[model samples]
Target: MKKENLPPFKITNEILTLIYEIGELIGKISVTQEFEKNLILRRENRIKTIYSSLAIEQNTLTLEQVTDVINGKRVLAPLKDIKEVQNAYEIYERLDELNDNSVKDLLLAHKIMTSELIKENGKFRSKNAGVYQGEKLIHMGSMPAHIPELINNLFLWLKNSKEHPLIKAAVFHYEFEFIHPFQDGNGRIGRLWHTLILSKWKDFFGWLPIESLVQKYQKEYYTAINNSNRDGESTEFILFMLKIINETLIELIENQKMTDKMTDKMTDKNKKRIEVILKYLSQKNYIDNKEAQNLLDVSEATAKRFLNKLVKENILEAVGEYKARKYIKK
Candidate 1:
């Protein structure tokens, strides 16, 4: 393939517009320090991504089981399925270290993502391959002899293409699925790499769990792929993916707004009391409920509620237990 050769896709009006909307939603989020600091939310999103991606490939683990496995608890699912979840987590947690443009890193990712589960882990298939849904094949890959050059050409174009990352990511996803480059784990890896490509454009895509939405629209996801295959271009898939990304961004932004409204939902008096507590904490080490009652000139119960509200909003953290608890800067 020549450097000027681009992939089989078109830049339709809808793809461009969704890209713009996704960018707008992205700009609206500072989210909060909590989104970054809240390890629980991060873990949940990671688990959601792993569960949904594997579920698309017919992995037998439930969401609860995936969570348990990631949390280092024993789950009764098939050992192979459990290993797939583990492998996915391993790869996602190490996202900062992988290069989106390198075929070498792609293979390394495949290796880690399929280790102990597939006989051809880390290597491209030595025979022709196709994507399957249940017992039916939906798409066939290039012949075994063509796999290496096709992948190399794809990557070379990926590095050189001037297309938007959203478009590029979708095209790579469509092409990777079209290539079915590996003997197994193509769907999961294709989705993972699409996210890696976008995460390169925006860091938070790594944790955004677009897979959950894809899982919600699983039938449409495959239909989009099948449509692109039938049409001989990836325009259908690109439109489908850009919409998913836009929807995820809208969801994130709305959730962030709701979290912000926790403060908005406060009564005027409660809001003033919160302001007082914040001011006090700027100079003091911590604020106990007794101190809160005295400073805010309120009853013990009201003062305690205010302090707890601050804690829940992530503006302050509660330390100690029961009557001994104190509120400190988070």
Candidate 2:
């Protein structure tokens, strides 16, 4: 095996502080019942993950369009765009099948992620590549002949390193972008691989939309990559990513608190009714006044009141007009 010089990065005060805060946030998130008990919130977060990750790569589909695609509903999109959505959806659906530390599994992920977007989806590039902003070259990857060796060595390092997973994943992400291993889909694959590494260490990361925060701070993301390359180490990029991860966790914790507060405000009778309705909706997807009446053994007027109360509370959504309206769990 060819030995390679893996890029160097170190843990800093900022990194340690961010990691501790992230740990605190994760502890709060784990103990919160809202995320664990509310199926709809989990599903929505997954949709956000898929939508934002693809959007970073210039996929033009709206969040609603992505949701429709995942639900197996047809939408008018370019074939390439639709294929990209489907490919990402499939990759996330089968994330357990990809081993985070396996180079071969990374290749499989590239194949799935870029199925219809590139000619040689799963393979390393046969020619040199560089990151560019319009006309200026920002960073050049290793020589084409060394791509496979560099990647294998990086994974080897990941396997042997004693670093915390948070730091290891950020290092891997920065190095992967620097390596630019594949012909295309490098950005998406790098992001996906970072998520895989974290999720392996802790499963909730499998659903967290870290990419959403990256998309929100895209300029900072690109700047961090450029700075890391300039410094010949991943310190800059690692710190930036650690901060983003902490912020994402804080958002989840605060939102969970708000949701729990809202749920607590409901009357006991309404809370019981809501639980029954959610159970039915899990099977039926949607219910109208008549269906609600039959399911809950309530009068027609009472059924209308119950369904409308859920709609008002934002726990259920009402579709259509008046007598024709139906309610779906939000």
Top-scoring candidate (lDDT) = 1
Clashing pairs in 1: none
- Model 1 vs. true fold: TM: 0.79
Tens-digit lDDT string for candidate 1 (1-330): 223445777888878888888878888877445356645556668888999999988899988788778879988978999999999999999987999999999999999999999899999999877777789987778788888898998998899989999999999999888888898989989999999999899777888889999999999999999999898889999999988988888887776676457557888777667657755664467999999999999999989887887788877899999999998987
Count of clashing pairs, candidate 1: 0
Residue-pair clashes per candidate = 0, 0
| Position 300, candidate 1: lDDT | 96
RMSD to the hidden true structure, all candidates: 8.6, 4.7
Error of 1 at 219 (Å): 0.3
Q: Determine which window of 10 residues in candidate 1 has minimal summed lDDT.
A: 31-40
In model 1, which runs have C-alpha deviations exceeding 4 angstroms? 1-5, 31-35, 263-330
